[model samples]
Target: MNNPYNVLCIGVNHVPVRRLSKLDYAEKDAKTVAKYFDTLKDKAHVTLLTGENATRTNVLNWVKQCSNIQGKLTVIIFFAGHGSAEKDENNKKLERCLWINSNLDTGPGSHQLKTSEILNLLNNPLHQLIFLIDACYNFDPKQEVSIQDIFKQFKESERMTGLKQYAIISASAVNQGALEDPQLGHGVLTYYFLQTMAGKYTFFLRRKISFFRFLAVLDKRVRNHRFLTDT
Candidate 1:
């Protein structure tokens, strides 16, 4: 556990709300994410948080307690759940980062966690942090409550301060859906990332492999997959 880099994979397969639509591939998604870290078990401390039983308390604990204080701590947050966007009174937009146990039917600030709140957790001086979001907001154009609508109201630049060497990598681009497949048992983007990193894929520039190049490999694989559901 003294390796300096600690990777915690939090994959929630269960939602809090009963009778709600469930993710058909949550278990597979969670398992795949865990497996990815299992490969790094020899070099770094790896923790896997999976299943519908995962709670926010455990997540916060892992981030706050398990982080390496002395060395280069690379913390990665991977969520494969629902996400939304909400607006403030001054028409400011905010990214409503939902946990697996989130209650989407509730009013603003009810069951969801703001992206800012999560960012605040990582404000402390750490080695480094990376957030990978595999969730997308469902926007109904006619309702004027588009996901992009809420995000347009706020400036990410301001909120992104104090996050030293932090990078946010999302699964979907602008106005794109986060694709999932039952057969693959994971999100398309995550699956491809694992495949690319399967064999000692370099995570740092010192290894002469940029993250951009790593992603290109994933993008190519996803594009060639005939069963991909994303548009």
Candidate 2:
């Protein structure tokens, strides 16, 4: 309970709307990550938000509260649900968005949370925000905007004033889908992440594995995923 990390694990198995397809292991993926942290028993707090509890409002409110905790903190927003893209205002561009629980049938803003919106909410100096999105997007042409381009927009020169740090790690690349299988019972992204953390595989630069080094291992595993889905 005294650790400096504040982790929020969110996974949604189903969206209320009839249009969205039901998922088999999204919720389980969330609990799996949360359980890993729970077993570590070294975090300041591990808040697991699954099913309906991970709605837009609840998630936003919790993030809003993080700004008030005046101290050095690492706030990790680990999501294992769906990630898609929405058309921008000009209708010529698409932005990466994370969809939670929303009953609305309207466009992206109503039922989805854009990466830009998340940056705005967690724009605090005291806490470092880390985003882990395991959603499957960009397999289609309409939503072909890559996560790399989306995050690039936020590197505004103006944000250098007080922003601590914002790091985002996605499960898939530009044109791939975030993958999962019934056999693993967990998304490929989540599984490899756990493996990386557990030191299951050796790295060439194992002497002092940096964050980028860790990401390299995960990126390799996801790219060569052995299941039905490909990330």
Candidate 3:
């Protein structure tokens, strides 16, 4: 089926590193999200990149190719994994990045992709872009600066570009962990997001819910339930 929109769902469940613990349900989260978009096969072209296939090279290549397509296109990227940021030599915050692979080193060969890189790659070719990040912002507790503050800084950098039609929904607030629910077998944010998308909440059943609306509902659900910290 031909769809006007393209969706890229990337999930990193297992990072092959001894220092990094495995996200057992991340693959499940990715698959579930991909399937949810697959249901909209008539309206969107969905692609799933997970596990070993979600390397930095592969993900960037896909973004570059998507940018070259000529049309009024809406591209959505959903990532569920570990999110990290490194301090510059002067102790300033660098860009928050997604760990696409198991490499924990902060180097060129680490297989990490920065949010800025994604934006730069997708610039000027798509009609709209959305980022759904289900990961922790500051995994290090000694950083002193809060994740919310870091996010604000990130947004300020983005605003300088003057791109207006994009939205970013991250799972947690400052210093809060993006938790997971073991009983539910999914990430806390991912579970609620899918639940809303599936119309499991009756109030949203008949409405064309916007991303902001979904996030509002999700925040409520998360606050009401007990979720385990992502360790």
Candidate 4:
């Protein structure tokens, strides 16, 4: 009953291919986010995978392992890496993938971990999954109902069944890009996210950082970023 959430922080900066550009702060950013979760009520456990360790195979395998865990679970998946909305030859649709560490960054889409693939693996009746995507080139993921509605149901019943909760917070809107700031020493999304979590604002001292408040401040600062084009 102690560990309420299983946090997976996946960051891949070292792409082993010429087709994709290397990143500067992805590994650092992933750790930063994982650190935040570690302090979340001391009930959220974290598993971090970065650089070579964050290969597509390993990450998928880790999630698969967690899916087999019994009882109610809140799974938080955070990714900071190179992502794109490119044309998939197989489906002929715009496929979204977060580029992980692998030798094959081209031809086969297996190394490029698809967003849908991750979702499919954790599609259980008793899981509350949150996707905090810090990669570039993303679209708003579709929602079934809303997180609020799910929370209401969860609160009303001690033993709810047959459905799960989902919420996604992307760094940018569709056709937009996210970046790491050289001066800030972190990705734009990560930099501000850490600042807000660090209680830079005067709000946290007065009240615990709830999701709504934290996100409100984060969204405001990100949209107001001078160099950032979209949010």
Worst 10 residues of 2 by lDDT: 155-164
lDDT of 2 by residue, 90-196 (tens): 75455667778864565646767776776788777777876788886552455556666556544431111223387777875443467777667788888887778
Please give the lDDT score at residue 214 for candidate 2. Answer: 71
Name the top lDDT candidate: 4
The digit string of per-residue lDDT tens for model 1 on 1-231 reads 555456666565556544335666655666677666666566667676666345566666676664425555666666676555544446455445555553235544444556566666665464577666666544334345654554564344221122346766665543445667766667776776676776455553224476666656655676676344433
Q: What do the candidate models score in CA lDDT, each in turn? A: 0.58, 0.69, 0.69, 0.70
- TM-score for each of the candidates: 0.74, 0.78, 0.79, 0.76
Please give the distance, in angstroms, between residue 164's alpha carbon in candidate 4 and its true position after superposition.
Answer: 7.2
Q: Clash pairs of candidate 4? A: none
Best by TM-score: 3
- Backbone clashes (count) for model 4: 0
Worst 10 residues of 3 by lDDT: 154-163
Stretches > 4 Å off in candidate 4? 39-42, 103-107, 138-164, 200-210, 226-231
lDDT of 2 at 63: 81
lDDT of 4 by residue, 189-216 (tens): 8788778867745222234656656667
lDDT of 2 at 190: 86
Segments in model 3 whose C-alpha atoms lie over 4 Å from true places: 88-91, 102-109, 139-163, 200-207, 226-231
lDDT of 2 at 193: 79
Sorted by TM-score (best first), the order is: 3, 2, 4, 1
